[model samples]
Target chain A: MHKHLLLGVEAIGQGAIDGGMSGVYAYPGTPSTEITEYIQENELAIERQLHSKWSANEKTAYETALGMSYAGKRTMACMKHVGLNVAADAFINSAITGVNGGFVLTVADDPSMHSSQNEQDSRYYGQFAMIPVLEPSNQQEAYDMAREGFALSEETGVPVMLRITTRLAHSRAGVEYKPVLDENQLSMPQDPRQFVLLPAIARRRYKSLLDKQASFVKLSEASKYNQYTDAADKSMGIVCCGISYNYLMENYPDEACPYPVLKISQYPLPEKQLKKMEAECDSILVLEEGYPLVEEQLKGYFAGGTPIKGRLDGTLPRDGELNPDLVAKALGKETYVGIQVPSVVANRPPALCQGCGHQDAYEAMNEVLADYGKGRVFSDIGCYTLGALPPYETINSCVDMGASITMAKGAADAGLIPAVAVIGDSTFAHSGITGLLDAVNEKSNITVVISDNESVSMTGGQDSSAYGKIESICEGLGVDPAHIHVIVPLKKNHAELVKLFREELEYEGVSVIIPRRECIQRASRRKRNISRHANH
Target chain B: MKSNIILAGVGGQGILSIAAALGTAALENNLYLKQAETHGMSQRGGAVVSHMRISDKPIASDLIQMGTADLILSVEPMESLRYLPFLSAKGYLVTNTTPFVNIPNYPEYEKVMEEIHKLPRFIAIDADRIAKEAGNARASNMVMLGAASPFIDIDFAKLEDGIREVFARKGEQIVEINLKAIRAGRQFSEENK
Candidate 1:
């Protein structure tokens, strides 16, 4: 039986289980994190002994899922769009290798950069890999596609990409689930050399992958997800993809749309359906959530192709997520303009919580670094990244996970003395350690501050991979015992912390300062949970 | 009948709880519901809003179009006014009068109230104060939901049942306090209306 209310992430998780997936491997990422979390929390998944746990990183997650598939078990790997970049090498290669059982790589794209560094579409990855991609229009579709995605992969013997944008991933609706399937039994590939990627074998595999493209396209054309809904009005045709289809339908709630609509979810362009819509309608309007992939292809070069309109031709804004108002405006409908907001209502950007350990660390660091001037601190992605915000304004750069240490090392090598790097506990584990190792090897004159909150507080306080192990990890990385300093971040310890920061800044070698404290929010939540449990 | 609502508040102010209660109630009434929420970076104390649509018919879009929302339910006064564009001309603005003063530059509470009062239809109440009087200050979200209950298309009793159902895991005392808070908020809105 299906749940009355199911979140999109939950539906995907449930669908994966029902599709007979034996394992789900992932790293914690916004919009994509909940899929793995759902499976981990599920009772059936636990009983089945599914491999649902956070991997070291996206690359590890991807490779592990491939291993599970090699063992002849249906498997899934999930990550946010940027994480796909880290796993891209393996992901593209896996497409040629082909799967023994079933494999699905789900990447959640954050258009408008919601909790992400960039809004790069994941569909390009699918195209680059020469693999099929499924983009669901709604929560129910998310479930259906996930359940069916494994079979699609098994049939083609190639991994499939299930792409979803932020809005659809976070939205909630009722989803009726399919009956569960038992886990696939362990087995090996028929060909012993299938896993090998030698020059000769890779050439053969690549050619075979190229040969599969025609079949993939045919599959898309026959897919129930790709449909051409004919309309009487042929003046303007609409080609809507994924959640954009819903936005298009929202414009015409009561009556059918006058223009022919080509709704596309499964990709490879579904050329047959597109040609049909083109032949019937005068012009085409492409509605896609992310980068104008379909629009660019349809527009091509040298114009004269049905006057294609979309993010390219100002039919809609080129950037940001789509909404019903934007869709209505594109159709020349009157839009609602609400009352102007008073200037008194200032922009309330996200800030660190009161009594946060990062606040104390920033206060002390700022006091010590005041003489060094600004632009010396390179930060990583985490709650500590908020140090770039007001009051403290301590951090200079926040590129990606683990960029802080490496960026600071580069600056130090380029004669920027006393270069400082700030990273959180979880981020250090995620990707910061290798950079630190490089800095240590070079003996760079830099100060690395690991703001140990003991938990990943930014993403709702998930367990930190480096929990209770920061100091040991730093030591293991070969930092001098005397130079590796740990301090309690608090008001009473402010002066001592400043002194330690000054000492580290003046040191000619890599110095590590670990300001350790539990995240106040997580600490309180822990307290509440413990008390509630005690009462129970 | 369809009810399109924009629930707005500062992150961590319990707007999602309000959305959950309404969604549960709407589901019990066998009404179709679609709720689009904001998660991730903005959740770190940024302004957040959830678009909730309830209808006997299917909801096409997860988002509610501007000027189509029947109600602007907010847990913060300034946050309530932030989504005025989403509110229909005939929509009711039901908001808690409390100012979540997390930022240093938060506007004057009186000025926020003044802006809210300028609306054609609104119910402004001190949900925090009422929730405290109801014996649980943490139930302020329930109080705000209660103040908006009269405008919501669902039955008040169903909403109460939703509170019971959602808070059932937290134990009977927690559920009772929230019920009291909802009743207090509903009574205030009734008298003012």
Candidate 2:
């Protein structure tokens, strides 16, 4: 038996390859970023020439995967929960169009907003799209489900949704490997018009999809991932889903848990096993990582006969990720309370790295804008977003990836002169270009600053899609060549940068400022790699 | 035997490396291991931690419960105290004496050390100095791991082997420097004891 210590993301990548996946498409986002990165760096994936490059965004990534699936080859698209929202159009439509080959959409949800804007669950998306959802409780199970999910999808002619949360995506454990499978032979759908979702054909496809729901429920009921294990105690039955099952197990060590358990790793509620557990026990306790989907469903419209204890009933906290201590308390076990940290240990929130280009850009912007006052600078997500914190406190808003440019445009149009937008290079490519075009067309008086770090530095220095193309993209967007300014964000250039910002702030037309500099972290990583190569 | 450890430090300080070394050693001993790490936003020079558990039996949660961690191994002095809540009542707290002062209001270095010293069980070492003496200043994380190695249940030889395995791809010279750093750290702890 071959075993290796792998992260959950790495295991998923290996599982996809072992399951004969032809390509894995994704846009870089935390927890989910490593899935494609692992595949990109894998020797087997490179040898097989798998399509594992980062797409422009999640929407393009999913559509590309769907197009590959049309050619009868296994494919996977991965993104974070928020990225699913961006890709929801293609994702929901794919279910209506069905699939000729195996397809999987793996979404990593961030519980408690660990590295995300909000803790929105993706299982709801699966239910919304009417697709089979697979949730894994451990690294080994993540691997197995990723491999088996494809076969299940091909068997049912529908895409599968493999959902995981932050903890499972970022954690590491030992996973045993299975024999690798060969890629599927190229083929086409039996029906020529299967993918053409015209109104008339779509209605018929909708009915067929509705017909598959019963079979999907049956599959969930029969799946090995969802099981009912018996115990002596009948006062309460426990229902643990996904990672919650592991936290539940943590509370019961050395011996088996007294309560019967319905471990639901596959979706559709696994009604048969849940019904059996409910009948055998007086009450039921539900343990889930995110929202109380099971508890809310079991409770129905009103409080029912059997007590359903979970986040809904306040048996467990309603929000945030679950831990063993919380699980123990839910199980009515006494837990040890650790000591508090002394006050001398101050809060060390994440700050801009020393010598970051954003720091210099912010310093110049802050100096120029101090006379005009605050709240005019709108920033987007990236390392530059850290300016909202103490010391800088320059940016007023951080909504989404591309909201900075458009929000600034709206504010400038609304008569807020010198409305400045701050964004990073990767984010600009991700979704900011169209907003820039809007600014130029409307002749909004705003100064847009694109901090060009030549990398997606916030997410561990992934390759930036906008590298070496930011200035050209801005120029193509119809900004005048004279108004476009590029400056190296350095201490020596601070006076020049401030002068350019003042000039742009004075201009009534849209102006673009490019603060170009390589991220210090990325530069150091490159240096190390070059030095290592020299040593070799 | 089970060892529940909380490895703490600021991002980019190589706390993950310490966890990797211990994880490799645990695997060599045929022990089951689970490690939950902090990634994404917090990794931008913020305080980060990893919950590492190794057991002869199957591990349960990736997270260590409050007051249940057997050891808190840290590479930064202030970062060492951040996870005090995870440490057991009698848990060992091993930390580097150096401070990674990034914030403006980083409490006095002397005060931080005082709090660490006040702990019931603790060992504070100047890992940076020792690592520099070991021929590679960058191996301070290895030095911190060596200082905490005594409190861990895994065999010392397995940890040395783990160092070899983790640095194997980086070449033999890098491996030798890290091993020396580990030995120097082990010597300090032994002399203090």
Give Cα distance to truth, residue B168, candidate 1, Å: 0.5
Question: Is model 1 an incorrect, acceptable, medium or high docking prediction?
Answer: medium
lDDT of 1 by residue, A176-284 (tens): 8778887789999998889899999999999999998999989999999998899898999999999999998999899898889999999888888888877777899
For all predicted structures, in order, the TM-scores are 0.98, 0.98
Tell me what TM-score chain A of model 2 achieves: 0.98
- Assess candidate 1 and give its TM-score to the true structure: 0.98
Interface RMSD of 2: 0.9
Local error of candidate 2 at residue A190 (angstroms)? 1.9
Write candidate 1's Cα lDDT for B116-159 as tens digits: 88888999999989999999899999999999889988999999
The residue-by-residue lDDT of candidate 2 on A123-163, one tens digit each, is: 98999889999999999999998887789889988899999
Q: lDDT tens string, model 2, B1-193? A: 9999999999889899998998999999899999999999989889999999999999989999999999999999999999999999889999999999899899999899889988988999999999999998999999998898888999999999999999998999999999999988888887774
